[model samples]
Every structure is written in structure tokens, then in C-alpha cells.
Target: MSKAPNNQWWRGGVIYQIYPRSFADSNGDGVGDLPGITARLQHVADLGADALWLSPIFKSPMKDFGYDVSDYCDIDPMFGTLEDFRTLVQHAHALGLKVMIDQVLSHTSDQHPWFAQSRASRDNPRADWYVWADAKDDGNPPNNWLSVFGGSAWQWDTRRRQYYLHNFLSSQPDLNFHNPEVVRALLETVKFWLDLGVDGYRLDTAPFYFHDQQLRDNPGRGKATSGDAAFPDVNPYTWQRHIYDKERPENIGFLQQLRALVDQYPDTTMVGEIGTDDSIATMAEYTRGDDRLHMAYSFDLLGADWSSPFLHNLLQRFADKSRGGWPSWALSNHDVPRVGSRWGGPDCNPKLLRLAAVLQMTLRGSPCLYQGDELGLPEAEVAYEDLQDPYGITMWPEFKGRDGCRTPMPWDSTAVDLGFGNHSPKAWLPITGAYRKLAVNLQQRDPDSMLHFYRQLLHWRRSQPVLIKGEQSLLPVHPQVLAYVREHAGERVLCALNFSDRPATLNLPTGLQAAAVLDLPGLQGGRLQGGELAFEAFGGLLLSLA
Candidate 1:
């Protein structure tokens, strides 16, 4: 059953994120494309997702896996033509799924025509299109900024005898948003997509749109930890305070401008990926007053912390600080390791993974589900030679980059490449042999499968309005047991989740009796008897109180 839309379809929406290169390859070529995604649109709708957010599909050099864009206004030939995208959008809309594409607006590939013109000479019409700066007297970069992928954020350009700032790869130069012309041109690109019938955009590295005009060096973090979702020990980029390189004051205005442009198109929205010093606070600020992004998400919950106390505190803190702004929560995405493997350990604990789906769906915000996660797929073991991620390549052995989580989806256990696609050699990334048990065809026949659990959970979530738009409050419970009450318009539901591997017990509050135990499919029932509640390991309970 497809979802029916409201004017504001994003509110409490379940967004399914698809990494195109790994989703499904249609025309072979060893890579997934728009047609492949179009063919699978029914799968998303059947999965009970309200919308689908696709990772970058624009023209790119693939340095950062489609993040470094060479052209914003056209679809990459590898992914098919603009007509293919239009067809995808039409198919998705027919399935009642709003189509949201990734907009990598902060930087462009070094081979971009704009960059080519900007670097031609000092007198070119677009000489100032990028952040070009004269080197210091010692021939060092203008500032001490660092790239999220690795070393210095600035790269020397031989043609102009100057350095250009690149927040990521040296081949991906940061656009000078300080220039009015740059902003205007980018808006035109956005308009092009909007005109083509795209519903929204997942703004990439949103705070990175603007930088410090003076090119000031960032300060050090003495005992402080990293904030850009990177562990300080793994990458030096997280060591600095990052007060000047990104999250500048100028970013808010640009966001407002972008929001205003999209506002012209009805029901069009944006969700920005925020990775600033204080991402939750930034999320609140960026989405506050509905004048900027319709909603925003941060990497705070994307970390390795899966404790009940951590989850409680993070949600509670965001609730306390957000004022009236809405926030989107995601446990997994194309950029991070799959939550099933990341949090569930080597076994990819099925019980815990199922409980997490319930918890994520019940949370008081829109939730995003990563592709392949509904099947309880673990992180694929990619050999060193198969690693294509530059980030993973630079940090090998210790960190495998994101290729493990970005493996192709498994469709049929009996089919070659697990039914991901037919390719000359293989899919973009190899599907883990272990995923054969979790393939869609196999899971479809198993009522207890993770795939069925996700579908049932999402369908049940849609019927519970309180969980959709409720005011959340933490319940005092065992540290390993996360409990919360969701209340809205005189209807209330108590949700309790056991996050451990063993059984747990909690006392029922005085004068409260569960009016009824809600039938949450695929979740083990927690019993309430003798003034106490008993829960199985990784069990979850949803009940109405009298």
C-alpha cells in the first residue's frame, strides 16, 4: 500500500536512502544507475517508506564517489541521461515516493568548466569563482585548514601560481560562495532539477558552503574531542577547533536563500547534512523558524555509541535545545557503516537490529533507513585490492573506508552476484557471501525475516499518530533499558527497549496499568505481571497506559 501525501510530506516521513552505485545495476557496466533505481521503486513503496533519497547522481569524476561534481545541471552518462532521471522521478511519484537527490554544492571537481575558467589566469572572468589565495612568504598554504579526507585543505595550482582551497580531495576545489555570481549560478542549477520534477535535495556537507574570507588559521583542541564525526586519533582533520574554515556566519544566509528559492515550488523541501562543532545545536539553528532547511540531521548519533544512556541523553538534549525546530534522525547512511554491523557486533545480532528499527521509527522525528539494512546485512569484508574509497585507502587495515557498508544489495540468493545485477566481471562492490541468507527473495518467504519486520514496523508506525508527532519524555529505567513516553492529543504510548544481550526487568510506575499491549510485529513480547515488567534480550514493548 502506497502512502497518501499531505502538503508537508516530510514531517515524520520514513526516508529510504539508496547508494546508486551499489543499489542495482540495470544495464550492466558493473555499476547501478537511474534505470536500476526506477525498476526498484516498487520495492521502496512496498517497504513502507514515504520517500527515497538517492546519493549523488550528477556528472562527476568519481574521485569522492560522485561527490566531486564536474557538472551540476546534467546527469552523468554512466547513470543515464536527464530523460532517465525524469522517468525515475515519474515512477517514484506514481509509487507515492517523493524523490530527493543529493546536491553536492559545496565543491566541484577540478575538471569542472567553471574551475577551468577560474584557473586560466588572474584576469579570467571567473578567476575569483574559487577560493584562490596567494601563498605565504614561506611558500606555505594561506591557512592551516585540513581536509576531512586527509592533509591540508589547500592545494597549489601551477597555472595561477596560487593555492585553491579544497575541503576534500585536491581535485575537488571549494566554490567561493562569497561571490554573488557563484551563488546565483548554483541556484540556477538547483532550479534546473526542480524544473525536472525533483521533490527535494539532501544537501551535502551543508555547513561547508561558505568559508572565512580572511582565510584565518583554525585553533587547536587541547583536551577537546572531534566534532566532525571523525575520531581525533584516526584523522588529524578533527584535531583543530575548526572555528574559521567552516560553519562560518555567512552560511546561514546562503541557506535562507536556497530555502527561499525552493519555497516557490510547492511541497519541495531540503534536509541538510550538518557536521559542525556542535551538530545538534547547528541542526536546531539551521532548521529553526522554517526559513532555512525544512529539516536537518547530524552525525552525533552516527557514532559507535549504542548505549541506552547515550541514546536517551542525545535525544533529550536535542529536544531540550531545539526549541521549535524539527530534526531528522538517521542511524545509517551511505557515509557510515551499516548500523546492523556497527552496533550489533560480528553476528549482526538479529534481535538487537529488530529492536533498533522499532526504536528508530518510534523516535519523535523523521527517520532515514539505509538500503540493505532492513535485511540485517553486515559490513562486507572488502579486500585491500577491491577498496575504491580514497579515505579507506589512506587509512587501510585500521579503517576500511565506507566500501564495506556500500556493497551491492542482495536480491536473490540463487542468482549470480546475489541478484544485485549482471556485470562483465562483478557488481561495483562485491556482495558479502553471508548476505545470501538475508537476500530479499529468501527473506520474503520467511515471515520472521528482517525485511518483513521493517515493512510491518513502518506500516504500524504510520497508523500511530502519537508516535509520529508526539512530545517525547524519558522514563527513568535501568541504564541498559531505554524507555520513553510519547504523548499527543490525549493519546499516549509507552515504548521500552532492552538494549542488552540478556534479560532485563523494570518496575511499573505507581497507579499505571498497560491498557493494552500494542501488537508490534517481529518484536518479542515483554510481560507485565506482579507490579513489574520482564523483557527478553533485545525485546521491545509498545503499550497504552490507563
Candidate 2:
């Protein structure tokens, strides 16, 4: 008999994030579609992921890819029809893997009917649906708000003879969430997806849903801090405190409303993306109770800080502030550089990849694994001519953009295009030669491959209830080594990871009886001698302690 479904499945679940355009291409159209995702569902289920979170697939103008939605209720023809989506959901359900989709609720493509109508004339029915403000006497923007994509956040509209707010590209306008009508309209759209059988949602730009009602000028940061080193320092978005622009307290009420709507559906969940000055605090606030988001994630783990102190401090800080909240941790995604290249640099070995997998899986929160990370695929080299990300295009040499991480997934080493799609069709983004050796077929045959290690790690994690739902306590160890203990229901496991590329030794906590050393390939297991534990370079071990 099958096991009963748990409504709180997301609490300690593992979610695999799929970038639709790069996952798999069906219909021989050189683009990944719903049918392709449905066909690839087995791979995810086999990988031990409890859920799959798909990026946006709504009707779009392709300005910022699918982030600029032109229609919320329909699927983009490039992706497929509504029926295709329903079929994908059905297939996922059959495999016991829940399906979640990205919901871009902050803004819409300028081509959206509402935006078009609002820009036509101020007297239109949808005029107040979007944020609009009057230009200053000197014909300048009303405030000092800056767009994330560069330039002022306000764009001029000749039809309305006023400036409109756009926190991103000029083609994408921010919605007026203060308006009750706008909030209701967005809720109706959310209901449409819920009715379509999606298990949950990954709220894109969740913190940007509401802006300061007074439209106050934001204060500026003195200089670039170490925290701002995550992305390229080409834009001014990172130079401000961003207090008035995002993470406004008023947004909490809207989140409550959203939570209420999702509560109407059983076994439904929502995970928000929180990016702001104090993202960790914001994550805690958004998920403080069941009245808002079920879980939230920040860019703390996704940044370039891979040191033992950095990781330990971040986890400890979240634990201190989380109270009863939940967090979702991700190492690599479509937005940033791949972890293999980011943390490992040029010499990112298979051992480091295995270590990363072990650390993420053993973390106390829900983990989100991005596509191709299981194969240890590094950032692909997208030449200047092939660059697609607008952020990279604008910032050129200083920041190469996110195109490197958004390349198509490699399936077959011998097949052209690596079996991502038909060989005859040209992919939206090229699959470079560097990923050929890391193809799925190639890795499947190698027991020591990163793919195999990831599979083993995830499967092993599922069997350890203490690692999944236990309370985590940081243990003292060498500065280059991270050690922690997870305990639940009288079961305790000690997890130790060496952050450096050199062997390290540390003394284990006393009064713990070692039961067995977890089996992991490509690295030496820890040996306890006179209460001292020794580990090899990039080695990780989990010990069952009583």
C-alpha cells in the first residue's frame, strides 16, 4: 500500500529547481516545454527529490525571459498549452513528486493588457493597477530609487505625461499593491494556478511586492561591503540600504492574505525568495508563523563565502533568529555562478563537489538543488556574441552576466547538443564543450562521478530521520573544519566537513559513542584516535552518536 500524503511535506523536504529553458527540449523546437519536463519527471523522482520547483512559464515577452509575464492565467505558447501543464502535474503526482511553479507577482511585462491599458490614458480602468507618479519640476524622477537592471527606477510615459515605477527593466512595470483591486486581481490569478492542481509556488521577488507608500528616498551605503561581493559590482543596486524600496512592513499583510488563500487548498505550500539589506531577518519575519510563508530562502549560502567560519556563522545566525520559522538553502541556481566554479575555483575537484552535496543535505533546513548541479557542472563560458542576459550585456567585462549558469543540461556525451534537444535545431543558449564530459550518460557509468555521489547522498539522507528533522548544534573544531551535531528522538549524528583543500584534525565532543561511519566515495572517512578525529582534504563524514 502507498503511504498517506503529509500536508506539511515541505517542512523537511528536498526541492529540485528546474530552469525550464535549459532542462530539456521537446517537440524538436530547440526549447524546453511542458511535455519535456513531464518526460524528465522520472529522473527527478529517481534522484530522490520530494518536489520540483519550475521557474516561470507564464505568457511572456522574453524580455527578462519568463520573469516578465504578459498573462498570468495562461501558459506561453513556447512552453505549451494549459493542457500540457495539467498533464505535467498529473505525471508528477503519479510519481509522488509535488510540482511547484515560479510566481512573479511584483511586476508584469509592458505588453501585458493591464499595463497597456494603464499606459493608454490615466482615465483607463487599469490606470491605478500599476505604480505611477508625477515627474519633479526639473523633469526628473520623483525619488532616488534605482532600477536593479541600471538607471532610474522611473520610466517616462508620454501618454500619461507622468513617470511610472519599474524596479527592474523599463519594459517591466511594478504593480500598485496598495490598491485593493490590484491585490484582488493577483489573488485571483494565484487561485487560477491552485485550481490547476499545482502543489505549491516559489514566489519570485517576494520582498518587492510592495514599496514605501510615501516613496521616500533611500539612504546610500558608504562603500561596497564584503556582502555585496555576491554579484558583480557594476550596478548601484547594491550601493543603497534599500530600506524604503523593498521589505516594507506593509508587505506582511499581503503575505498573510496570500497564505490565507493557499490555506484554502490542502497539501499546498509556498517558499519565498527574500533579497534585501537584512535578508536573513526578512526571511525570519516572513516565515515567523503559519500565517505567512511556509519557508523562505536568502542569498547568504549562494554567495562566494565558502569558509568554515562563514558557513557556521550563517547557520548559527539563522538558528538564532528563526524562532519557529523554516528556511530553504540553495548553493547554485539560475541567477548566480555554479558552485563548482564559485567556491572551488579552477581546481574544483570531485571531492569538493561531494562535500558540498553532503553539507547541503545535512543542513537543518529544506535544501533546493538546481539543475545540473548533481552532475557537478561548472559555469559554462558564454562568449560575448552569445550573451543573452541583459544584466551582463549592460555590465560587460566587469560582470559577464548569468548566461554562464543558464546553459542547457547535458544528457548524452556523444550526441550533438548533448541530447538536451534535437541536434538539427539551434538551442536558445548553446551547450558548450566543457559540459560534454559531465553529461548524464557519461556520469551514470562512473561510480565515482558527482552524479552518483549526489544520488547516494540524497538517498542516504532520506533514511536518516535525525538529519532531516533534528535540532542542529555547532561543535567546536579546527578553523578550516565545520562540525555539527543533529539530534532527534534520542538519535544523534555528528557531521564534519573540511572546507579547505588540505587535511585537518580536530577533537570530537566527549561523551558520544560512535556507532558507524557513513559510506561516501572519493574521500577518506574520519578516524577517531584518543578522542581526536582526522579528515582528508575536502572530506566529509557522518557519525551516528549515542
lDDT of 1 at 425: 40
Q: Give model 2's TM-score versus the native structure.
A: 0.97
* Residue 504 error, candidate 2, Å: 1.1
1-546 in candidate 1: lDDT tens per residue?
222232887888999999999888888878999999999888999999999999999899899889999999888898999999999999999989999999999999998999999998999889999999999999999989999888999999999999999998999999999999999999999999989998899999998988888888899876556644444357877778888988888999999899888888878889999998888888888988867888999988778788888888887778778887778889888777778777877876788888888888998888988998788888888999989999899877777788888988988899878877773347767767888888999999998788999999999899999998888888874677898889999888889898888888888777567888888888884877766778988887888977
Worst 10 residues of 1 by lDDT: 223-232
Candidate 1, pairs of clashing residues: none
Please give each candidate's TM-score.
0.96, 0.97
lDDT of 1: 0.87
Task: Give Cα-based local distance difference scores for all models.
Answer: 0.87, 0.87
- RMSD score of candidate 1 (Å): 2.9
Clashes of each: 0, 0
Candidate 2 lDDT, 1-546, residue by residue in tens: 222243788977999999999889887788888888998899899889999999999999999999999999999999999999999999999999999999999999999999999999988899999999999899998999989888899999999999999998999999999999999999999999999999899999899989988889999885575273344566778787898888888899999999888888888899999888878888889999778999999888787888998888887878788897999999998889999998888678777878888889888889999999999999899999999999889888888889999999898899888988877437888877889999999999998788887887788778888878988989853588899999999988888998888888877767766787766554455666656778788877778785
